[model samples]
Target: MTQPIVEMKGISKSFVGNKVLNNVDFEVLPGEVHALLGENGAGKSTLMKILTGIHSRDEGEIYVKGEAVEFNNPKESEKAGIAVIHQELNIIPYLTVMENMFLGRELKYGKTGVTNTKKMKQLTKEYLQQLGIDLDPLALAGNLSVGQQQMVEIAKAISVNAEMIVMDEPTAALTDREIERLFEVVDRLREQEVGIVYISHRMEEIYRICDRVSILRDGEYIGTRDTKTVEYEEIIQMLVGRELGTLYPERDAEIGEVKMKVEGLTSDAFHDINFDLREGEILGVAGLMGAGRSEIMQSLFGYRAIESGSISIEGKPVNIKKPTDAIDAGIGFVTEDRKEQGLVLSMSVKENLSLPNLKGVSHQTVLSEKSEKELVDDLVKRLNVKMAGQNQEVRMLSGGNQQKVVIGKWLGINPKILILDEPTRGVDVGAKKEIYHIMNELTKQGVSIVMISSELPEVLGMSDRILVIHEGRIGAELKREDATQEKIMYAATGGE
Candidate 1:
């Protein structure tokens, strides 16, 4: 057998008395795409961080090409031929693609202390071309689409002469065509014998690209197997450490009378949209990226201006030109980018939970700590938010817990209509189930929900009715009984 390219033995890491990784073993071989599978908070990220020198392990032995090495920083790890492409891309949006490629390690001109721009651009262009990327080297990072930017990131890795690449959810924001292109790049890298560590929650990608699968459950290594020989259910069971039973819970909410109605809704991004959301119903908005699904929701939530529309709640017309108006009208919106748009990261969990209904927690022109605490405590307990304490910073929580906090904060508003934009976007399966249960509970309490999701399974499984938006128009409205993945895709792509 050929020697492994990268190996970790007896790895363990702890944070503030919490053991995140415990004696976990992971390795990758040259020319192999090794998948690091785990649920959120299952220590996948922590383990990867340790390997990339972003975090120091409390106990472990790391080897590169059969030689022991201890890297004290990310630069050292990169120098040792390991590069990480994080889920949330780390790129300077204002910088040009070529500039970003050689940001830290620029070529100098013969002791003149001047950067060799021509050399950097030439190298970046060659690297991008090698990866089958056609993006212009001089283009600003922000001007490129998500897919193009990801390609630039990969090209940057290659320019650094990285032998091993760790890609975290590389396809999360990519379109079908873009994903295909990425896979092409991955195949080329594999052909060149570069070891790749692929981490993602999407099972289909694992089956499509990975050679070997390794499961981590609650910070413990379960086992590894050849991807081709492993059953899909077996992988799920291993990562979760139990039978999932079902990906989505059974719907039990009884649809009631129409609680909110929209007529001839038009915006810059969408046009002439009409829909009715019933009490105790989950109305799912489905579409491809940039199909205006989020734009419609944002307009309805008063985050964007509606060109023409009539919104009625309980048979009464309402004007919502701002978020405050929407909130006053009993509407709650959980934005798609939770970290940037939904929660205040610097604030404590309790403080964020109390933000939606500050007046309710205040007393006569002054804030009341007792009232605030009581409200936050109720929300935290009700939502099953995992936090050290109410005073803990929200940014400290995991992606799943942070999402729960975002939802819990909106629940504090006691809204009659709730709008969730990609509520389970980056969360794990366990977290996704918890969020679904929460949605179910909300509908049970007579709250109507407008859920916008890119994941078809999520929309089909949870929604009582699905609205497919295509090219800024309502292409199809599918009843719960009629919607399927194929049908949804057909409609979402502008099928008649």
Candidate 2:
């Protein structure tokens, strides 16, 4: 057997009195893609931070190619041929691809302050070519798609002669095509004997690209198994430390008359979109990236102007020209970009939760502290948001907890109809199941839902019916019993 490229034994870490990683062991082979997976607060990131020198391990032995080493900072890690590609990319948007790639270690004329721009550009091209990326070296990073910017980041890592690369949620924001491109690059890296630590919650991708998976729960290492010999259910069990009965709950809520109706919902982003949301129904919206699924929902929520449209709530026509009007019409919207659109990261949990229910917390025109506390407390308990306190900033919570707060904010409104866009995009499987249970509970209470999700399995599992959008129009509407990934993809691509 080949010596592992990197190894960590008896790793332990703590923050203030809370232990995060407890005697965890991890290893990566020269040409293997090892998956590091767990729930939101499962200590995956903490271990990686220790590995990359961003944080010091309280107790551990780290070896690079079987030689013991200690990294005091990220620069030291990179010098030792280790690099990290964070979910939030390190790309400087204003800089060109070449400039970004050669940022700190620019090629210079011998002993001179002047940068060798020509040599830097040439090297950038060569590195990008090695990854099979054909992007221009002179293009502005801001002008490039997220996938392209990610490629630039990878090229920069390769430029450092990195033997090990850590990719955290690399495909969270990419389209299907972009994901395919990233997988191709991973294959190339594997061929070149580069060790990759792939971290993501998407089980499909883990099975497809990763050779082995390691699990952690509540800061303890569960175990590692070869992907070829592991069942996905087993992985979920390791993640949650229990049997996750089913990914989706039963849809027992009975369907009733239409709660909201859209006719000729036309806008620059979409056209002639018509749909009827029956009471207690989960109407799933599915489409590829840039297919206007989010745009249509945004327009219905009055975030965008419609050229011509008519909306009827409970069979009564309403003029919703703005968000306030939509809210008044009994509409609650949970946006796709939860951090940017659905929540104020700087505010406290109570403050964010009370933003939409201001009227409820206020009697006539005056605010009532008692009402606010009651509302916030009830919602937090219901959503099971793990936080230090209600006063803690929303940004301090984990990804799954933050998403719960977003949904909770809307739930406080008690609207007749709820619209969720990419509701569980970055959430873990445990949190996702919680959300599904919550949705089923809401539907059981006769609340209608419009769910826009890119996860096809989610659509098939939860929806009473699925709508496939193609070129900004509803291409096919299929009952849940009749829908399949193949059929949806075909309709999403304009097939009849």
Best by lDDT: 2
Winning model by TM-score? 2
**Which 10-residue window of candidate 1 scores lowest in summed lDDT?**
239-248
Kindly give the stretch of ten consecutive residues in candidate 2 with the minimal lDDT sum: 104-113
Query: Deviation in angstroms for 437 in model 1?
Result: 0.6
Clashes of each: 0, 0
Q: Model 1: clashing residue pairs? A: none
TM-scores of all candidate predictions against the true structure: 0.97, 0.98
lDDT score for candidate 2 against the true structure: 0.93
Clashing pairs in 2: none
Score residue 44 of candidate 1 by CA lDDT.
91
Against the correct fold, how does model 2 do in TM-score?
0.98
Candidate 2's displacement at residue 231, Å, is 0.7
